[model samples]
Target: MKDKVKGLVVGVLLGSLLTGATAFAGTNTKISVVMENVKMMFNGVHKSTTQSIVYNGNLYVPAKTAAQTMGESFTYDGKTKTASFGAKTGTFKYLDEVSYARIDGKTNRLYFKNWTNPEGLKFTIAGQKYLHGIGVILDEPYSYDDQTISIDYNLNGGYKKLTANIGIDDYTRNSTNSGSLIVKGDGVELYRKDDMKGGDMPESINVDVTGVLKLKIVFEATLDNGRQIDIVLGDAKLIK
Candidate 1:
């Protein structure tokens, strides 16, 4: 079955490539093209299709078919004659690109990057360094009190996924540092990790944010032998 499916072919078109090869058939453009059956596959999996073509040595298929095959959404508007694809897929928007509604329960910090410095935060975890994402010190030096940082985003129900690499920065990797990470969507907890240490590998976070209007991430650190650490959310972004 796999062999037969792998050989499945769609139509392909090939023809002349002359400079004056400009014409129209009915309301659509017409050109000298050869139609053939071509098989398509991705990652050893067959991508079944009924209509496809080869034009100028390139394969062409319906935009909707291609997009859908890649797990993306596609839409067309007849009245406007417009097409839309990949609204909540195959698109990533950095969290820093937009303004947040609050930080640690205060709206005064409209600038999100201030928590990590203007140049952006860099942190090392698992022998690797990551750059340009939200990072903040969770605990104060010599302070026995527990500290927490909460960054909130007003998603406006537009995004579908949230992704980030979470970990403690190497600045305190050698110290007795520990913390908890929590992610919330619309006042509901979506993910949580307790007792994370600075020496641990970065935790890759990829959570569903569908229909989420308000997104919140909280990092809380406990006092351990007067040690401090930078809890980093590296390369954090929202997909829509």
Candidate 2:
């Protein structure tokens, strides 16, 4: 009787151990994270953050970090679950791969590729191709005197500023390529750049859009004796 009891106890303990191990194995889950390789610079300094992620083909950084990068302040209210930046207030929500703060009042969107003229031409230099449907890229060796591309935007009077990153991307080693960056709205000139040369850093431009109804960005290049004269309007948009 004693031997039988001991054997029964041992069997129960082994069964329990096996059952627990199987349950643990069944509950184990695996997760995958995708990383993107890209460099981001803000205000002439490199900005690094672990919370940056790429979701749905868009790169998103932390709200606070992004605000700080733009030299702006950020505050979050736990009670109302809202994020406030200056005069703008919005609710924050986190998704699987990205997070966003939806503005409470009004917003405006102007994507460069969406506003580019479709009838413009495309060019290629040293096996790198640039399409006009996306953004304006000018690189010609006196093939044309001047090239122009038009972009139109209709405003709802809620936006406060128009911002864009404009720069030159001259691949030619010589220093003969030059051009001017011009922006006009409704036949009124808003912005102009006449001394754009090769190997110049990109500069951020902001124009006040108080009561403007229409907006247009024109990229015109005056090329000299050079092989390539590239100018790109990088990530142009409107801010509210």
Candidate 3:
């Protein structure tokens, strides 16, 4: 998934999690990434500790486990100096003393800062502007990241997420309105908020926030395994 909050402040360090199947932990460095159940062998490739990056107690490889295993486009550029793999191609760019990735032909940015989480451990994307970030729950980074059965090419396994928008109204100088919501840290979320309750939402439950009102919009979601994610709307402003 791409992080859209590029120009905006990085905000606080959000939580991270994986909501899919068991992780594939391996010790062998010569890892084999199976795409749609077919082995993916790179012709001229370099290798590192393929098992160092663990997800859900399993080593995760961004190249094979996340993209290749899911049958997405993967490539690298020594000239442009970037690495892209899977269903999404990321252009590695440096900004504010940190490495950030951007999807080709899109304004969304994917934050690649090193993440240290408790749950089985994996990578994370944060600070999105326009929604489109994807959560990759991999067992062994690349070896088994997608939710598909190789032998029959059928999706017998995967994960599911619940999403909904939030709204709040009635504004004053310093008001504390109800329906104050939040998106859980583990999964994906989108929050739409303005000075009033009736803020703009791509998929809105309500509309029309044109008045002296203090509002808030939250895009709440629940994962398959009873995990909830809360994404607060970008900003909270004063109704002048």
Candidate 4:
């Protein structure tokens, strides 16, 4: 009932803290971001596409995924790389902190910063906001895990829930989520799809799509007193 909606989500590198951080683990070391031409005007609805793919090799251009493809709130800091892009930017909608994306592009599901704990299990981004602040906890903030949240993606066209947009997380145990960030396929719905409140701090929802092909944004969060969490975005996925 109180969702103002700010948005952008994508992250990895969770060492849980930093100090050499296992020299940055590697699961094929993935990274890829490209939103071509950058013309996705939310609040008014505008989507321009030229979509490319490398995303798991580290190449997300179009000015750093254009604030999570047009839903603001960004962050990144993998041991002094630095990247913090608050929400609410206008006049063509832009934000910067030396962006070229090495890391730092704030995530959704309400803020997830300070992470980079390498050898202990794995976590990798430790420089954001200013580009460098190593404390590493890179990944594992869906609330300490019980596990099951999967979301996938792949769409070529179709939309009009007023240009769809959503990602939601109800502060632990309450569970209220929704999804629809245009870019259809596989009936996308990452984490129940519905997150946006007030403005700042990783929250976004802008939907409009009917093109679903390889879109797989899943979710499965179960925790009331028991324990469960597993979420993945960027290729969309969630499990609990």
User: Which candidate wins on TM-score?
Assistant: 1
Candidate 3 lowest-lDDT run of ten: 148-157
Worst 10 residues of 1 by lDDT: 10-19
Provide the clashing-pair count of each candidate structure: 9, 0, 31, 111
Runs of candidate 1 exceeding 4 Å displacement: 1-89, 105-121, 142-146
For this target, which candidate reaches the highest lDDT against the unseen true structure?
A: 1
111: Cα error in model 4, Å: 22
Q: Backbone clash tally for model 2?
A: 0
Residue-level lDDT tens digits of model 3 in 1-240: 222212222111112322333323345344333222223233324322232233334433444333443344556555865556444312221111221221221112111222123432222113223222222121112332122111111111121222322222111112222123322212222233333222323232222222312222222222222221222222221111
Which pairs of residues have clashing backbones in candidate 1?
11-52, 12-35, 12-36, 12-53, 13-34, 13-54, 14-34, 87-240, 88-240
lDDT of each candidate versus the true structure: 0.67, 0.46, 0.26, 0.30
lDDT of 4 by residue, 1-240 (tens): 012223432343333332231233367553333332334454676744533222445523333445554554556667867655554222121111112112222233211222222222211111102221111111234544322333222233322221212222222212232222223245444223433221213333333333443443333333323332212122111111
Q: What local lDDT score does residue 224 receive in model 3, on the 0 to 100 scale?
A: 28
What order do you get sorting by TM-score, best first? 1, 2, 3, 4
Models 1 onward score TM values of 0.57, 0.45, 0.20, 0.19
Better of 2 and 4 by lDDT: 2
Cα deviation of 47, candidate 3, in Å: 20
